[model samples]
Target: MSKIKISNAVKKYGSNTVISGLNLDIRDGELFTLLGPSGCGKTTLLRMIAGFNSIEGGDFYFNERRINDIDPSRRNIGMVFQNYAIFPHMTVRQNVEFGLKNRKIPKSQVTAEAQRFLKLMQIDQYADRLPENLSGGQQQRVALARALAIRPDVLLMDEPLSNLDAKLRLEMRQAIRDIQKEVGITTVYVTHDQEEAMSISDTIAVMKDGVIQHLGTPKDIYQRPRNLFVATFIGRTNVLEGEYRDGKLRLDQGYLLQNGMWDKIGDQPLKVSVRPEEIVIADGETGLRGTVLDSIYLGLNTHYIIRLSGGEKIELIQESTMEELIPAGTAVNLMVKKEKINLFTGDGSRNLLRGEAS
Candidate 1:
């Protein structure tokens, strides 16, 4: 197990800077996931850690030693790719043993190690099958087994489950998590899938435009995103534009976000996120009167899109089989607590609402 650290690391391609002086510490024996949309430079960061990509500036350390100059093979970092990178000509056992053989490890020790991980990954039964003879999931298991056979200190995965079906992806997630726990190797996984990262990671770093926006537990990133970009990117968010005026908030359409606890600033335009589940849709209340424009039935929740008095739309979610199902075009009430409303300044950095979760 190892602690991987990146301090002010910068990577440039041509004149474009893909990553700029980023700093992060991945704890020892923990599964840390880098999550973001495509072209966010998540994969580039992963490659830099594995020594597959050079660090043009700053330093990367494995434990206490600086490894910016260490070769990929000597760094003792194992990498698994998006595609099942198994040799089609080699059997599962041969594939797993290939790395050890190249390093001139004892044949007996290599065989034992290969067999051990093949069983651990549950691919021992197909040890003799060629890559094409095995299923996609099985091939991935072989790739994982191969990567783990050498028992590297750090395991790096770049969207390893992207090629598999959804069901297989779920299975691989559990398998990967379980294997990492059993072996206790420090792991860094990269993926664009939020659910996948939130499921298996001990910690997550959400990146945007080659920078780390927020690094925390899945719950932290989802519940208390630091910025509007994070709140809208990491999960679902209903953005409401409003202005703070006289201890109250006026929406785009003149509907007030009433709050008894907060001191409203005078005429400060702000964007607030009202999570769908936090907004309660009900009938017979004079709360922001709106006409229901659409009712979207999500398996366990129904989402109602309502047009307020000033023709602005607000969405709210009702529990499964809500007894008060108002038809579209019917009048409804949108009730949201003040705390659930997240207020952000125009620049999306500083939060205008004091003492509120970021």
Candidate 2:
């Protein structure tokens, strides 16, 4: 395993600067994920680390060694491409053995090492099968085995599960995490899928347009997002515009913030984000009044779209444990858990609820 340090890294194509002066440090044996939408330069950064792309400026280091000019083949990194780039003519064992042979390992040890990773990836039985004959998931396993057979210093994956079916994606993600833990290789994963990154990453860097918007654990990113973009992009949230006054937040829809909900006080407009599950649909006449606009049954939960008296829409997710459904057009009182709300400046420059709890 190796620690990756990128300082003031820049990538440009002529006049277009895709990544601008980015700095990051990935710990040894850590599974770090670069997550963002398309065109956000997450993949660009990953490729730069793998030596597939050149850095316009700045230093890229593995441990204490500077590898800015090293060739990709000599970088000692194993990369798993999105398409599972396995040789169609080579059988699973042969494909895994190719890298060992390229490094000129003895013929006797090549088969043993190849079989080891193949078994680790649970594809030992299919070692003799060609890539064309295997399923997509199986093919992906072969790709992983081949990458691991080299016992690289770092492992890089670029949306490795994007090609599989949904169920297969889940299975492969678990398998990948297990294999990565067992091998303890420093991994850098790039993906646009938020759930995938949250599930498998030790640390996640949410990027946008070429900049990192937020970097933290999955729980921190989801529950205490630092900006409106991070809050909305990471998960489903209800953002209500309101004003901070004295010590309370006064919503435009007439819902006043409970006392001591936040520590800071300002008189500027702010946005409050409440997760769907954090909202409670009150039974009596104690909360803000709203009418149910829509209700969707999703097996595990019932999602309701509630339009407040001021015509603002808020979604509430109710667990289906009781199986009681509220019909549309029904009047309801909505109350949000004050402590669970996230407050951000209207321009999304700061998070007011960053370190304070109710």
Candidate 3:
């Protein structure tokens, strides 16, 4: 029942607008993420949904009801912030019970509800510990438990794992994903980490300068981005210039890629996005020629830096084999996976592929 629909939303600080005429649809029981770099206004949009920021322009709805005028407290939202906001003065149990008490839940019911979420978050053993006594990860668990103890209609998380260490961040992200699926709450998570968003979100809206450049599932955005910026931002991609004419593209490295899909387009310059894994070593001399500049051998894969004949440096990842590594200065020919690569327009504004978003 908590599906959220935002229509032509806008936010401005005085005359400078941050979010301009944005629209988003968040399905019920889905973990949706607003992902972008710092100062991209992802947080600004989250606050708008929480009713903390004033709507300078459009309609905000929760299912059939309008919530633009609703108070933050009355909107029925649970928020977990960057810093573990649990009170130092209260024990974990008290922190979880705080919201229930504020809503005038009976004392006995509050205790039971708090106990339930503590168990759900796997923090029941630390229920009596004050915030100061628990580790950062445990403290975050308490914060999550407290937020869900109220059983709000929607959950909003803003960089909740930023304070945790590398290992704990991974652990906590998995825990959060599991808990969200169990509770089936319509949640909106905001984060700057691309990997974190890709791993946990049902849908992602990649924002830049307050505008959502792409909105789709992780696979769609990563595999076939709508534009050049999105293809580069969502993951590591090698950008190479090319010219398209007669249903074929002449890569800068002197390789020709032909596809019937390009028949409708006129001859023009192109920017190609090829992921590291999308380029493979070809037999004989039937592909783009390059020289290996260096190779870093990881356990399962070896990452190689290559300088193409056209003088462009690119990285490619190949699965490790029993044979010895290809040393630097070795000449190699590479071929791109035609179906996996993306071709953007000359200005990088739009993609020429048919399946991409318009």
Candidate 4:
């Protein structure tokens, strides 16, 4: 196991900056994920760590040793790419043992090690099958086995399961986490899939505009987002436009909300974020009173779109399997949980709910 440290990292192309003054410490043997949208510099940072992209500034360290000048081969890091880089002519066992062959390990020991990881990846049954003959899930297992065959200090995966179908993605996610834990390898995964990162990672780093907005556990990143981009991007959210008037929050349509506790926010126009799951839609709730515009049933739950009296749209999720449901144009009470309310300024930088009890 090895801890990875990125110190004051900066990456630039010509005059364009990709990453700016980033600092993070990844604990040994923990699954840390870099999560963001396209062009957010996540892949750039990952490539820098893999020595595929040279850093314009800052140092990269593995444990106590700095590897800025070290070659990629000497970094002792394993990487699995999005495209399963399996050779068409090679069988599953042969592909998994390719790294061992390059290092010129004994033939007998190589087979033994390949079998070991094949079993670990649960692909030992497909050892003799060619890449073309195996399923997508099976091929991914072989790719993982190939990476793990060399037993590198850290494993880096770049959207390895993105190509798989939905059901296969879920299965692969579990398999990846299971093998990662079984091997106890320090892993860093880069993906734009928030659900994937949240489901498998010990901690996630949320990035935007080439800068890290926040880095914390999955729950912290999801439930208590630091900025507007993160709050809106991580999941479905309801952003209410309001201003603090004498400490009380008032919506755009003269509707007032109790905010005597929000002292730090003296009198600023604040945009509050509430998840669809946080707002309670019942018969006589406070806050925004809205009329249902549409309600769509989704297997285990139903989603409701509310057109607020202030003309703002709010989403509500109900887990009930009740067939008798609310319809369009029906008025429903909207109540946002004070504990789940995430308040931010118009710029979406300041977290107004930081000091208050919830």
The runs of at least 3 residues in candidate 3 whose Cα sits more than 4 Å from the true structure, single-residue gaps closed, are: 356-358
**Top candidate when judged by lDDT against the true structure:** 3
> Residue 258 CA error for candidate 2 (Å)?
2.0
lDDT, residue 150, candidate 1: 88
Top model number, TM-score: 2
**Per-model C-alpha lDDT, please?**
0.86, 0.90, 0.93, 0.88
- Compute each candidate's TM-score over C-alphas: 0.91, 0.97, 0.96, 0.95
**Residue 77 in model 4: shift from native, Å?**
1.3
lDDT of 4 by residue, 1-358 (tens): 6999999999999999888899989999999999999999999999999999988999889999898888999888888988988898999999999999988899999989999999999889999999999999889889999999999999999999999999999999999988898899999999999899988999899988788888889898788888888899898899888788786877746766775557667788888888999877766655568899998888888899989987888889979675678889998777767667788988898676664442
The digit string of per-residue lDDT tens for model 2 on 293-318 reads: 89999999989999988888999998
Summing lDDT over every window of 10 consecutive residues in candidate 1, give the lowest-scoring window.
349-358
User: Which scores greater on TM-score, model 1 or model 4?
Assistant: 4
Residue 297, candidate 3: Cα error in Å is: 2.7
> Model 2 off-target regions past 4 Å?
259-261, 356-358
Give per-residue lDDT, candidate 2, residue 223: 89
Residue clash pairs of candidate 4: none
Estimate the Cα RMSD of every predicted model relative to the unseen true structure: 2.6, 1.8, 1.5, 2.0
Residue pairs in candidate 3 whose N, alpha carbon or C atoms collide under 3 angstroms: none
lDDT of 3 by residue, 208-297 (tens): 999999899999889878888888888789999999877789996568998877777679999989999999988897898999999999
